[model samples]
Target: MDEESRNGGPDSRQFDVSGAKINILSDEYDPTVSLISSNEKWVEDDEVPRKEVGTSSFWQATSNTVALLLGTGMLALPYAVMLGGWSSLALLAFFAIMFCYTGCLLGSCMKENPLLTTYQEIAGSALGLRGRILFTIFFYVEVLANRVGFLISVGDNLARIFPGVESHIPAWIHLSPSMTLASLAMLLISPTALIRDLSNIAYLSFGGIVTSLVVVGAVAWTGTTVVGFNQPIPFANFGKWRFILGLYSYCYAGHPVVPNIHSSMREPSKFPVMLMLSFTIATTTYAGIGLMGASMFGKETLSQITLNIPRDLMAATIVLWTTVLTPLTKFPLAVAPIATELESFLPFDSHSTAHYVFGNIIRLGILGLILAVTITFPYFGSTLNFIGSSITIITCIILPCVFDLVLHWRTIPKLQLMVDIVFLTAATCFAIVGTFSSGGV
Candidate 1:
């Protein structure tokens, strides 16, 4: 049930700020909230109807956040650790702390401007329409590319399950790995993609987290028992250190979804605790997987840790297929924001049949586009690198720090402002070097 329905009318408010209540009858309502003028500013926006009503809890939010951060990104960590050597482990820990800082900035921004639920909204509020446009362009590029990468993974693993299953067909079939896998991805992800209410799919997100844990456990077991240890790489490879920063940045790529998860929680203030819990679990999993995979396989670690598993082992197949399933579950939630942002621009009645019809149309259209990209260029690692270097940096480190500085420029202490400036400078340099290195230029 929606907040309005539960509260008996649009006039009812979930949070009381300044003893004022704003009524938001529907999703189409404008989000204009009155702000408190005091030092500790607060937003009282009623139009941004409570997401998930009473169903969303702290643990659910944490699990979903884990599900988002723990997918495909972790798969590449073993390779990232290999690239940067053992020092990459230290870098991962340091970045995890930095990530938590930026995440809190995002949360604080959302609290100050409660009307802002989406990144585009936050960008527009801070930097105007052009900023919104800039953020939107970058967001869609990153999201679509990430989804395409997921589809490619699905296709590749499905092909692996039935090796030579394609060759049994006649000559005219002409099914390459990309083609076969792309078709399979569409078939697998379409049902989840059609889900409009993200709260309903929370279980799927929970399952994804569990699946990732299983995969991690399986990889750790295989890395310890089955895989033979080889001479380890150096502590840090200065030559390719840029690539490690980008890949590790990708491994912590959950900042973009902070607002969405924050908005869904029963109490937004608890978001920081949730973020801390989720990131702790995520970093532990990442360090263990990366260190174990790199230590066992050494220089021969594949880009995906699962690939290092001996194929004949049942654990290998399970991890491969779980890798496929986790992404399929995550693809929908990742793309929902893009669809929601697009829908706000079109002329469709929220209560009419056209809105329902058109919403699915947009969702399916996105799936179709991802499928086409997977078929056209099924390369996954390069795509991952590009996303890590480009949008991931923007959403994770750069934008949040910039936004916080702009939002609290005068209110925050000079020391805090200087710290943000330092963060922005360091992250920007990291992004630039990572981008160039990832492109092999």
Candidate 2:
């Protein structure tokens, strides 16, 4: 293939992934997110360099990486265990390990195709043109749906926090003014539009984690007494099918983010470290939060979390942070799909006013749609399951390994092949069951 044909994006822009330095990966939560922000141009800051952010420190990346998948998913994890039983958590741990291995595969993939810009590109490399078309088309659509779900949840959560605001309007305003405003506001801050790369988003990501930890701590203290730390952690039953499926689904949620994150760095040498660190922290956080929720509330756990604990001051703080920062989660999700779509036509568009304006309009629509869906579901489990499960299956489990193997199958190390088999098998089964269980969600 000619260099230009191979490199031209749908928009006809050069693929531009020249270095091991990271390209952008859009957010995992895509459906209802704003895409405009994903196009923001980055200007390298010599004064504040990569070394400042751990200089590719695995531990540092690990800390942020764990927090990456730690949001809304953790809040519901404990309850999933309760619904499915302790066996669910045990099963989930295996999925976590599997995802981490996927993370390693992704890291290795980056080492080879440091310029791989999107999941579709990686998939194309693996299985050829058909794979790229299939991967990109469905992936973007699913991301679009997820952005909608996330916006709705944000509205529902806001209403829960501010009864006054809810009273000022309808009790169920998933598509309410508040959601409209927040989504619009986020559209304005398109991370994609920002000059910094994916790592730059890490700045906000770290801050979000601090707030989440505080909330986790608050929930932990108020609820569970940890009556049995040594209570023979139950042996997992992968045979239960449904429970195993759910856990695997949760762990694989972070896989779609690999290509861009891996490629967008000074040195891809430490990509595996980032993935391992991220998953390890993520698993521990999920377990702790899940254990606390179950031990404390057991069957009584509230949907979308019953954080109605009576800490007026702390509640206000967390509510503010979650509401404000939470909106940002969908920014990358919004950006990725639009970027893909934009590439499909009129590929020469750059950072003109027309680009941002058009980008913002799409962003507003996507976010508005998310708010609308939440109005209907109102429950976190439903949306989380809906967007979370679909994306998790396509991007996280099946695609990553398939793509990696496609590109490197001729000489893939035996060890990597085994990891690929385990994750792909686990992901495929979970996707099949998730389709059935969440068919109507």
Candidate 3:
């Protein structure tokens, strides 16, 4: 490859499958980099000028990372355990550790080239323009699918909270109560998508973390007092192992945003520490809720633990409301990176009045697209299963390892290279089997 192609310079712009020009190095226009070279060499840890890099504190970044990981998928861990039996918790822990390691690999890639601010840039830097485009497509689909699952969760929980809501909908509308509620939620969250800064949403992300803990606590309280955890959970059930793997994979669907969170940190070198802390917290929460809910309602646990809680109990009310609130806070964080990338394609200066005018239009268009998909295929469990099996596995488990191996091939130890190859092979197999299994769901 030529020097420009090797470095993924701006002149390397190419057309995607959809016939749209995608500039993989579009960050060149970012004001933050006006004084810095895009091709600068990796700096030493102590050599990085932390005061010039970012604005977010360590805890704020931690909160954002936690919120991103512990989304609608966490609520389904109990159902995953039910499907795969008691042995599945082991798979969950294994995935948590492997994904955390891969996440740190991504942080290392960013550290290798501090100018790479997005996941696509990392891909382009390592594997060239095609890799960048492919990763972009996979990452965007995962985010959109997660948003769809969020709407589906909101619809299901809202319908459960008001059992008579379907009957109240007009016959002419031909919409189910869950669909109506999801539509309303789409409208409610549309405004937040317009926010340009991640720092502004930190508190909202923290709210998501708080609400997740409340839901977990409520599930525990209900399981102990109301449901009586005396049910028999099977030791192993390999019949649905494919679907179970997908569910576990979906729980770690936070890798795409890791780059964004890393970029937002004031001390980006500590990103590995942030990843370890966030994954530890998320894994612990998933395990606690999964064990408790599955034991209490083994073979009968709903896709969302909140769905299994007794409707008449106070714990159920708290769990239901908190579940509803969790997605609202997270919707913006999930879509912001996608929005920024889409806006970069506009034919105007990044700070021009024309860009501002058309940017809000683009954001609204994204919301409209998400709303349409959510309404058409509103099956919560099946939608999540398909996405987790197919897209989530690729983005969260497979690609990070591939990118890291490509970027650090020569310098990485022989054993570490073997480990990345093993992970890549296993994740690919699981993704294929799980996709085929969950595709029929």
Whole-model lDDT values for every prediction: 0.69, 0.53, 0.75
- Model 1 residue-pair collision total: 1
Using lDDT as the measure, what is the rank order of every candidate, best first? 3, 1, 2
Candidate whose lDDT is highest:
3
TM-score of each: 0.77, 0.70, 0.80
User: By TM-score, who's the top model here?
Assistant: 3
Pairs with backbone N, CA or C atoms under 3 Å apart (clashes), candidate 3: none
- CA lDDT for candidate 1: 0.69
Instruction: Kindly list the per-residue Cα lDDT of model 1 for residues 208-287, writing each as its tens digit.
Output: 56677877888877866777555486788867777667777877775645665666677678989999998899999998
lDDT of 3: 0.75
Question: 77-124, model 2: which lDDT tens digit per residue?
Answer: 656655666767766777777667776766676566544445655666
What lDDT, from 0 to 1, does candidate 2 have?
0.53
Clash count, one per candidate: 1, 37, 0
Poorly placed runs, candidate 3 (over 4 Å): 1-64, 114-118, 188-202, 260-274, 332-362
Kindly report which residue stretches of model 1 are placed more than 4 angstroms away from their true locations once superposed: 1-64, 111-121, 169-175, 187-202, 228-231, 260-274, 332-364
CA lDDT, candidate 1, residue 190: 80
